[model samples]
Target: MDRIDTSVAHPARRYNYWLGGKDNFAADRASADAIAAAWPSAPVAARENRRFLGRAVRFLAAEAGVRQFLDIGTGLPTAGNTHEVAQAIAPSARVVYVDNDPMVMVHARALLTSAPEGATAYLEADLRDPGHILAHPDLRATLDLTRPVGLMLVAVLHFVHGEGAALPIVRQLLDALPPGSYLVASNATKDFLPPQIAAVYDRMLTAGQTDIWPRTRSEFGALFDGLDLVEPGVVAAHEWRPDEPDPSLTPADVSVYAAAGRVP
Candidate 1:
């Protein structure tokens, strides 16, 4: 709790604000408002990304027969969290959430509840250090590394700046999992945004309040290299097996790319 810095805007908190959550501070709201002004569809894109998460988790648990999940960069707990979605399909499913935010850690209890047959755990770890997450006692105890696990990196990878930093971390995490494990990821992209809107976003990023690097479609797809992508391939978040396809949502409206891939 003491580690939480309410003075500056944080990614998770800003995301929460975008999602209409009440857990964020004034700094987060201000940043979110600024971004929304630049991109009117920002809030809608956030909701669509969350819906994509639910669909992916359901597919992994019900169709792929996966029983374990490791969700990194998990933001503040919301309505249909990974555990809830997975356990709804298989009550015995186990999920481990990873996030480095102290505020998220403060609200970890909300994410810890699990069905009697299933298990859930939260780890205070950063995405940059895969070793610490893999070796964490709580993660080891909650999930069986030998079995298939769902590695979820939804709406989180854009934070790691630099040209080649994000992919290696992704590969390292994927390598640690067994052959049958899966990788589910969604990242923000500038491919669909108009030049003026993209420039506004870039200007916000340049302020250094929080780092965000929106990738191109090809760059986002490269994160799933060597893994078999699920049907429909990589698409905009709202377009990925949507439960209820919104006629209004277009590529330009949803600026995030999402996909699920299997290790084998």
Candidate 2:
């Protein structure tokens, strides 16, 4: 547990706190509360993002017929993990989950159970080093690069600060997968937020109070430039083929855009 720092606020733990999970430290709770103090709808967006992940996985397994998945930036396991959602539809699906957090590894081993027919492998890796993630032994053992893969970058790209940093990383990972592969990505956006609220987020980001680097619609669209977008492309998180349609959630409620796209 030397790697697990209870005093710091990790994104996964902070997200878990936002989703009302009990696997968070006081630091995470404080960070979450800090965000919520300015943005009262933070939890709504968190729940919507989680729900979007499930819908994306189901689409990949049930409709796209993808049997392999590389879910990078996998936060602390809660309900409807990538493997669970995919394997439920395709019993023989194979998944390789990647995350940078050491604490996530501990919680994942206990919560992320796999189907007997399907297999799941966890790796400690960072999204910034897509090369290492794609070449990892555990990933190599779990996924077949020759076949199609579902590359899940959900709720993770925002951590990669600075302009044009995430695009190359995304492209590199996508290049490794076959033609039939798919990409499911979601990132927080300030497009829908009114100027006053957006300024609050901006000020927080500048003050080092928030780690998430919100992206513009054009910037996010650039991430999927070479791929063919799925239906209802690039909509709000809760708007992306929700399992149970929630009319109450407007674009401002879930300031995150979610979409799935095919490799070729």
Per-residue C-alpha lDDT of model 1 across residues 32-102, encoded as one tens digit per residue: 88777877777877888889999999999999999999999889988899999999999999999999898
Candidate 2's residue-wise lDDT over 223-250, tens digit each? 9998999998989989898778887779
lDDT of each: 0.89, 0.90
Work out how many backbone clashes candidate 1 has. Answer: 0
Question: Highest TM-score, which number?
Answer: 2
Off by over 4 Å in 2: none
lDDT of 2: 0.90
Candidate 1 regions exceeding 4 Å error are none
